[model samples]
Target chain A: MARLAVDVMLKPEILDPQGQAIARKLPQMGFEGIAGVRQGKRFELVVEGPADEAAVERVRKIADTLLANPVIETYEVHVLSDN
Target chain B: MARLAVDVMLKPEILDPQGQAIARKLPQMGFEGIAGVRQGKRFELVVEGPADEAAVERVRKIADTLLANPVIETYEVHVLSDN
Candidate 1:
């Protein structure tokens, strides 16, 4: 089986309030020098095959159609190697 | 500036209903062979310096205390190169 990681993030143009909240709170918590922050979603999928180009493509399709909303968010898919 | 990516995930033993819901829906949507699915959070932090070890350590601390709940979730921090 192959494992794929899909990271779904809001587009750069979109405002991320959750990330803004964290960025604002960090300094108060004594963590300084952070310029900005963005929050997103991550998914791990175990598929019934090797982590090949075909598998990556399939996962990419899955990411596009189901995992992410194409209007405001984008996603990236990566293959995870067996350990 | 440097960018750091922090991934926060539920512990393996924890239940992920969102993931389960996705997994169940995928097959119904005609996507097959997905053995399992797990959902998590991803955060991108832009700091006012190079992505040095100190920055990674600082992000790790932030992730532990604020971004992730240590009881049921764990986090990984990675330094991202300027693009």
Candidate 2:
């Protein structure tokens, strides 16, 4: 089996309220020098195949269609393992 | 400024309904060879400082306390940039 990791994030123009809330709380929690906390989603997929080039490409397509909203979000896919 | 990437994932023992829902839909979407879809959270933090060892350490501490819940999730932090 192979492992793939996909990260989905809001576009730069979009607003992220959850991230905003976390940023607002940082100072209260003693982290005073941080800013722009953008929260996103990560998906770890274990596919029943080798992590070949073709597999990775197919997973990327899958990520674009099912794992992310193209209108407001973007996604990055990585093949984590070939085992 | 520097950027830090933090990935938070549920413990293996915990349930992930969102991931399961996505897995269930993949076959209908024509992705039938993938299994074990686990969903997590990703946070991109732009800190107002250099990405030095001290800054990365501080972010790790921040992740442990505020960015992730240690009770049910595990978090990994990486320094993505120094500029």
Candidate 3:
């Protein structure tokens, strides 16, 4: 089994109140010098398949289709450790 | 500054429609035998500070107070390699 991490982020042009809320709180959280905390959805999957190029493609398809809102968001996928 | 990865997930008892939807479709996407795609919010923070215990504590407070809903979600924080 392998773990996949997908981050779904809102498009730059889109307005995200949730992201805004999170960003605003960062400073208060003792990260006084930090900025730009874009909030996004994260998906961690335990896929039972060979860790191969084809597996990544399959995960990408899911990421592109149902996992993210293509109109208002962009997503990036990461393959974490395999077990 | 260090990158902090915070994964905010719904409580175990909470019915997560988004998570449910994602899991249902993952198998079709080449993860044919895998399941359990939990949907959560991710925050990548570039905090400017010494990577000290205090800094992590401060970030934790912020995560508990604003970034995550205490009643509905639980969050796990990870500090990535500093840049």
Could you say which candidate leads in lDDT? 1
Q: Which stretches in model 2 have alpha-carbon errors above 4 Å?
A: none
Ranking by DockQ: 1, 2, 3
Worst 10 residues of 2 chain B by lDDT: B27-36
User: Residue B77: error of model 3 in Å?
Assistant: 2.0
Per-residue CA lDDT of model 1 for B1-83, tens digit only, reads 99999999999999999999999999888899889999999999998887888889989999988999999998889877753
lDDT of 1 at B71: 98
Chain B TM-scores across candidates: 0.95, 0.92, 0.84
TM-score-based ranking, best first? 1, 2, 3
Clashes of each: 0, 0, 0
Which structure among the candidates has the greatest DockQ?
A: 1
lDDT of 3 by residue, A1-83 (tens): 87887888888798878767777866665557665566788887777776567767777887887778899989887787776
A1-83: candidate 1 lDDT, tens digit per residue: 99899999999999999999999999999999999999999999999878888888889888988999999999989887742
Pairs of residues at least 3 apart in sequence or in different chains that clash in candidate 1: none
Q: Candidate 3, which segments miss by more than 4 Å at Cα?
A: A11-15, A25-31, A70-72, B11-14, B25-31, B50-52, B70-72, B80-83
Q: Which candidate has the highest TM-score of all?
A: 1
Q: For candidate 2, write residues B4-82 as lDDT tens digits.
A: 9999999999999999998999999888798789999999999998988888888898889887899999988888888
